[model samples]
Target: MKSISKYWSIFQITLINSLAYPGELVGRSLMIIPFMWIFYQLWKVTFSAAGAADGMINGLTLRDTLWYLMLAETIELGRPPIARTMSENVKDGSIAYILNKPYDFLLYQFSTAMGETIFRAMLNAVFGGLTVWWLVGTPNHPEGFLIALPAIFGAWILHFSINAMIGLSAFVVEDVSAFTWIYQKLAFIFGGMLIPLDFYPQWLQNIAKLLPFSSAIYGPARLFVTPTLELFISVMSLQITWIIALTFALAIVYRRGLAQLTVNGG
Candidate 1:
């Protein structure tokens, strides 16, 4: 209970700190507007070109695609760059200060990352949602937001586990930009960030769905589009499985990194 309170206080402080520069927060969020607009134009052309009955491609209509894209963008753009931040701390040896702190390092990072995520994601949702709504009317399942909420949170936990593992690599490599770039591209392609997995060929869809990246992006975004109980269960089940697996992997990596850790400076 006391330990939980300490992390909760850390979360609260980071949340408040994120709001300190409202202009920067809002400015960064505005990038989602152009992204949504471009998606609208590109997908409009795509739906037109495909000429699928009633503007539908695969299982999704144009409106559904737009809404899905909006949520996908919100998830991608909202989270803080945890890997890069941790890498910087490692490179500068500032992690020594953090190691001296009382709280568990992983929990502390999760609390702070989530605190930073809340407002950015909300703003991205507002801007991206309005843009998508204007491009195509309201989502078919407005209640899907409520339904997909848990999965969205789980998505971030999965992301943090993976990215933290990547960050932990910096203890040895001291630079992780290459790994970060590869991870982003993998997520964009395999995670259905650019196109829903349903649109993919059957074999590819099967493979992509099995990946943690899909659970982080595609699962929640798809749930937000459809929001059936079965999907909610499926998404959460996959997410929990990935979260548990990746979290254990992260712990192993963290322990190894600590043994290998070499701070460059005082």
Candidate 2:
């Protein structure tokens, strides 16, 4: 463990590698174009049928909902497949080399993930924004975006920590596929991916907010579309809290997993 700079360099390398396939990155980002249209039609039809007083549903205008989805997918689509990566490393004895390195293995893993994630996340966010512009024009909540900046950064940290926890669980579970799938569903339903939390029943919304899933995905998107200073403070505070808690939990899991490692020595 030399210093933070060492792992930061690893982060830089990972970021550079992600840019190696700029075309592929742009292509993958196009996935959001259709996503925006589908949701746009769905909301448009739903709102037309709802025929509410002001084209609003459950406290959100259709425009607000679409932007929420855009922000959510920006974070969601950028996620790396770390569970399999971690499992492969553990199975192939690569974990041994990683643990012996000067920089902290956990820090190195997180740095690399963040580095690569920034590339993908930036692309996804830009594409998603463009889709929003083409479909709905400028964001209705411009002020909300200013507050969302810190919230989005916090959410990214929380997102990485949650995935890192799943990956590090390779020590306890041979496979993390089931866990990741279940978590993804939770994120879709509770993290307000498929829809915003406001659409949910009051009790269900409470449960969603209580989970880290919401803090990771919904918190940032929610802050961007709904701009109350109180809410901005609340979501950012919760995101920071979850980031600390999840990072600590990941450290504990890694320490235990490292201690459990056995060598085949004469």
Winner by lDDT? 1
Model 1 per-residue lDDT tens digits across residues 1-266: 99999999989999999999999999999999999999989999999999977778888999999999899999999989999998887888888888898989999999999999999999999999998888789999999999999999999999899999999899888899999999999999999999989899999999999999999999999999999999999999999999999999999998888877754546
Model 2 residue-pair collision total: 1
Q: Report lDDT per candidate.
A: 0.93, 0.83
Cα displacement (Å) at residue 149, model 2: 1.9
Which 10 consecutive positions of candidate 1 have the poorest summed lDDT?
Answer: 257-266
Model 2, global lDDT = 0.83
lDDT of each residue in 1-266, candidate 2, tens digit only: 45867877898999999989899988998998899889999988888898999889898888888898999999888877766677667767687777777777877887877787887888888888888888878888878877888888787778777777787677777578888898889889989998898888899988889888899889989889988889988998888888889999988887777765663211
Instruction: Give model 2 RMSD, 1 decimal.
Output: 2.1
How many clashes show up per model?
A: 0, 1
